[model samples]
Target: MNQTPQAAIYSPVAQIDALMPDIAAPVDAADFPQTILRFRNDRAAASVGLDSLSDEAWIAHFGRFEPLPGTLPRPLALRYHGHQFRHYNPDIGDGRGFLFAQMRDSDGRLMDLGTKGSGQTPYSRFGDGRLTLKGGVREILATEMLEALGVNTSKTLSIIETGEALERNDEPSPTRGAAMVRLSHSHIRIGSFQRAAFLEDRALLEKLTDYALTHLYGEVPGDNPPAQLLGRVVERTADLAASYMVAGFVHGVLNSDNINVTGESFDYGPWRFTPLWDANFTAAYFDHQGLYAFGRQAEAIHWDVAQLAVSLRALVEAAPLIEQLERFPALYAQAMARRFCWRLGVVPGDGADAMIAAAVRGMAMSGTGIDRFFHDWRGGVAREGHDYDDAAWDAFRGAIAGFAGVEDARRHDYWTDAAPCSMHIEEVEAIWSAIDTDDDWAPLHAKVAAIRRMGAAHSECIAAA
Candidate 1:
């Protein structure tokens, strides 16, 4: 917890990471695929003023670093285990990720600035420390798109593509090498709690809970030993689950390692947005058994919360923790309702809210494309023509009928001829294939353009909500 001079100033959108004293062994990044496109840059974010760094400087920049100005950096290897595809994996720490440093933002918020694909460490297991260029690029686009969609996500601070190559089953011959700097609230996960549970270390679990509650959920007041600490954590996690559902997002892999103690979205691997309402819709191709399906995300999150509760069983009383966890579904539903109202540009009191869900459900069941549905709904259009005609209006009416009665019908017309919720018309097929193919940037770039437009429109609509 060192303090540095705040002689330097940065805008709200800009972030700064101070260098650490002790340097670790350098981990070389692999090379890009033949089709991979590379853009070299010295500066990190376009808006940030941080100067371009050399390879030596880049390595130092990503190494374990010191806290800046008025922040703290506790670079401890968090303990955790996860069930990878239903089979338990006992050892999984920051195998390839590290807390490079921590910093205090201008708003006095503590943020964890970390590196992924930097290099191998003691916990490196049997894998390469390098992250593929495609993976890094995918993460960058994912963060930007998610932020635009109004989801709680980690922001990509920088991406460094190296000129190296390696082999990987997940990609095309593994010629890509890269590293990324990400900004997040906390990187501790449910697996960390599960790891402590497996070891029967009540003391370590309690310590972790206290750290998380004190740092992440400071809004929840009360220090009633470990019970309150566990309660706060459970409550926040359930709330986070609700946020995910409202956004039609599936984390794809909600393993204990991916569920953050801060309840903020983390570890964006194999994630996807559902275009239909099937409870079993999955993003990962190898997921033969839809374990992390779109409809089951809430259940998956709740199960993770239960594991967290199990971690607190010995040190903190479990009954209260269970009670708090029980409230997740109801709280999630309410938050989801509010979020849906905002998404559809309706007031919570507006009776139209009721019909909208049914309409959406009907569209999904009837094979209306998920993102396409929203895109078109945003603009007043039907499946038939780009023109907003009576026939198009009739199709909407037919969809609204799925909602049942008049009470639900009120929510039917948020879509007008003026504003259409259009998906990336040219890239619709690409969206479907990106999940199936190796890392692809063409669709992502197109999606980002659509998201930018969507974001600008939301500015005016959010106020209306």
Candidate 2:
């Protein structure tokens, strides 16, 4: 590694050493011959006091999987069993990824540095533990777009292209290889509890709950810490589902292991943004049953929360946990209405829920492109002479007229733009094709810049409000 300036190392994970055995299984990363840095999120790095580190240091820690100073000497491949499409699978764990390191962000919230495609672990069953370059690119796009839309999501911290030819059935054979590191609040999944429950290990279950309560739900107050933590997760998961709907995103995989305990969306696989307001839109081609379809996402999440509640039974009374689980539907509905109104640049008020429903109905009836409609109707006003023969459009116009105009000045400038930053399937393919065919990166860079601008405008709007 090239010598350069380094930041002061900090390790808060040592403070919670007792929780390690119950939640994580230690492992080593696969040794790759090359580590070419492809992407670095300086904005996210600054939050964790890592922006000052040199490129060489970044490649050493994130690419080659060197231990970060003051942190764990060996990486932890977390052990968790999850329900894949409602079927309990105890044979799953971190097959190709591991928890690389842990630290605190500027806000003093504990953050984790988790790797993807780093290497195989004992859980690597019938698969080569690797990640394609295309996969890394897609994750970068997913996180960027979701962040811009104001969703609570894990940020892609670093992506390094490992110079290795890998074969895969999903994409073309002998595809490019890469590794990724994500910055998230926590990696403790609902499956972590599920594993304990499956093993009938009540002690481990309670330990995991206590760890979560202290690390992820410090603000949650109550005599029953387990119930309190469950309540918070329920609320956060509801909001997350609402955000997906408003943003027109489909996660494709809603497996229990994919659902982070902190309720932040991570582990993007086969994810997509819907082209239109179709409730049945499915992201993954293999999801023949549409179990995690666009319209059914809220239901799926509620079911997952219920599963968590079942695991919490190891420590808490069934009645209290069930009460928290029951709050999901109403909380989701309120969140959807509020998020919908915010996207329309309106202050949520009386009849907001009805308006949201009507808007969805109209969009489905007219087959309106979701992103286009939002771009054209932002601020609850259509451009001059714009006309649509749809009930939803009419209802939206009438409802938006009752509220004060958007307070964010940045929004006005954003509205002047001709189109919104969108991540449709065809567009994603085109971006990737450019990289594959001609080694071009301009388009990808341009898209990220546009998305960041939109995010800044939205942030200004929220702050002003």
- Candidate 1 residues 394-437, lDDT tens each? 44555433332212212333333344433322344455357337
The local lDDT score (0 to 100) that residue 330 gets in candidate 2 is: 94
Best candidate (score: lDDT): 2
Tens-digit lDDT string for candidate 2 (1-465): 001113433434643465767677888888898999988988788778888779999999999888888877889888899999999999999998998888887767888899899988888897678898899989999999998887889999999999889999888878888999999999889999999998999888877877788877766445997798899899999999999999999999998888988899999989999988888999999999999999989999889988899898988789999899999999998888777767777666788777777777768877777877777777666765556645647766676667654665335477677777799989899989998889788898888888887776666665222
TM-score quality measure for candidate 1:
0.75
Candidate 1 stretches greater than 4 Å from native: 1-60, 63-77, 219-225, 350-356, 379-450, 463-465
lDDT of 1 at 181: 74
Once model 1 is optimally superposed onto the true structure by TM-score, how far is the C-alpha of residue 404 displaced, in angstroms? 19
**Candidate 1 lDDT trough over 10 residues, lowest sum:** 14-23
State residue 426's C-alpha deviation in candidate 2, in Å: 0.9
